[model samples]
Target: MSGTIQFKQDLPPKGGYEPIRYKRNLPARGPGGLAVFGGILAICAYGFYKVGQGNLEQRELKRERAWSRIHLIPLLMAESDRDIYRREQAQLAREKELMKDVPGWEAGKSVYNNKRYNPQNFVVM
Candidate 1:
């Protein structure tokens, strides 16, 4: 036993605790390396490129459909209007023939409104 008890704090050895050994000490056993990292990066890049291409293609298809609707809608509306006018004309001719004996029944006369051309809509639906 010492006459006076002494307390000594533990200290690192020389060379500052062997440079701390901060790097991983596990064995290089996994299937990973620079080559694997590079391959994974390349695969991710390709996947992103394919996704971008698909998005672009989808956008183009949507644009085409939109343009087609823009061009066709008016033509379809005109054709439908023409068909309605033709049917009305046919009905007027039948009425003129059937009501030949009756008078004051004017054919192709506006009964509801005085406007010759009714207002049309431009909705996409």
Candidate 2:
């Protein structure tokens, strides 16, 4: 009878029971630190290379533009000088007609301010 005796509320074991989802889980290993750093460095190097190429291309374009402007300067000056010469010729003709009855005065001749006043002077931009 003593051996067969049982308590009304059966107690659990001394060690606690494990949870239901107790399967063994192994943590996944990621990429090594050196490999990750190398990948990041490669990306940065590619970005810098592209930027340098763009800067070089822009510099070439700017140089071409400056050279073109330099080449056109003489032509622009010539055209301007031609226009000024035509205007002076017209002014001289008008002055000769108007002052014909009057005495010895020239059209484009100035006693003073004559050092660089002619249309032959090359105007620079």
lDDT of 2 by residue, 1-125 (tens): 46687667777767877667878898858988899999999999999999999999999999999999999999999999898878777777877777778777765565566576644332221
Instruction: Report the lDDT tens digits of candidate 1 across residue range 24-98.
Output: 788877677987999999999999999999999999999999998999999999999898777766776876787
Query: Candidate 2, 86: how far from true, in Å?
Result: 1.1
Off by over 4 Å in 1: 1-32, 88-125
Which runs in model 2 stand beyond 4 Å of their true positions? 1-7, 13-16, 19-38, 99-106, 109-114, 118-125
The TM-score obtained by model 2 is 0.55
How much is 34 displaced in model 1, in angstroms?
2.9
- Weakest lDDT window of 10 consecutive positions for candidate 1: 116-125
In candidate 2, what residue range of length 10 has the lowest lDDT sum? 116-125
